[model samples]
Target: MKNAMPRTLDRLLASFLQCGTWAACALIGAGLFVGTKVLTAGVALFILLPVLRVVLMLAVFARRRDYLYVTIAATVLAVIAAGCVIGIRLGPLAG
Candidate 1:
């Protein structure tokens, strides 16, 4: 049972990533014919993939009552959030 749980979570995470990637690719490809909005959506999804993965890891750790990992994952998420907030505040001009 213990071993099975990790495998299941791994599979779930893998599938989620795969689906998200494919969806993003499809949107980008369609956008080539449709417009910039769809392409932007795809780009956003690509950027968000890592964040979503961390969120998934946080959820799994929390569910398993793994405080150490939960805290680590939470910290990573906070950092990512902070970076995004800073980037937004700075705006394109900052770059």
Candidate 2:
């Protein structure tokens, strides 16, 4: 039971990431073929993927009842969010 569940979770996570990657690529390609706003959305998805991955990690740890890891993951997520906000505030670095 224990071994089976963890393996299942791992597989689920892998499948989620794989599908997400493929979907994002398809959107980006279609955007390139089509229009401006679609291309912008595709680019936004590319930016959001890492943050989404961290959120997924936080959910996984929380599900497993691993409090310490949950805390660590949450902290990491917060830092990422903060960095994004700071970057937006600062605007372009070089030009």
Candidate 3:
């Protein structure tokens, strides 16, 4: 049971990332022939992958009663959120 959890989590995360990457790539390719909207969607998904992964890890850690990891993941997520908020606020001026 103990060993199974980590294996399951590993498999799940790996599969999720693989599928997400493939989908994003496909969208980007299609967008090349299609339009900017599809390309933007693909780019957004690509950028969001890491955030989604962190969220997944946070959920798993909470489920496993790993408070330490949960806190760490939560902190990382908060930082990401803060950065996003700042970026949005700064807008084009940020660059």
Candidate 4:
């Protein structure tokens, strides 16, 4: 079961990325003729992919009762979340 988990997760991650890419392409391509909000939503989805991956890992590690990995993943997730919050609050910076 332990060995099977990684393999399954690997497949799942691959599928997730594939779908995300298609969604992004559709959104951006259509947005080109639509408006800025659609384009922005697509860009946000692309940017969130890595963070979503980390969150996935964190859940898996916690489920496996790997405290060390859980801690590491949680810390990383928190940092990323904080950066996202800060960026949203800061808005566009001037030169």
Give the winner by lDDT.
3
Q: What would the TM-scores of all predictions be? A: 0.86, 0.79, 0.86, 0.77
Candidates sorted by lDDT, best first: 3, 1, 4, 2
RMSD of each: 1.7, 2.2, 1.6, 2.5
Taking the tens digit of each residue's C-alpha lDDT, what string does model 2 give over 7-87?
A: 877787788778777777888888888987787777777778777877887898799887887899899998988987988
- Please, what are the lDDT tens digits per residue for candidate 4 over residues 1-95? 87897898798788888898889888888789999899988998898888888888888788889899899999998888898788887777621
Lowest lDDT 10-residue stretch of candidate 1 = 1-10
Which wins on lDDT, candidate 1 or candidate 4?
Answer: 1
Local distance difference test, per candidate?
A: 0.93, 0.81, 0.95, 0.86
Question: How far out, in Å, is residue 81 in model 3?
Answer: 0.5
Model 4 compared with the native: what TM-score?
0.77
* Candidate 4 wrongly placed segments (more than 4 Å): 85-94
Report backbone clashes per prediction: 0, 0, 0, 0
In the predicted model 4, the residue pairs found to clash are none
Q: Cα miss at 54, model 4 (Å)? A: 0.9
Clashing pairs in 1: none
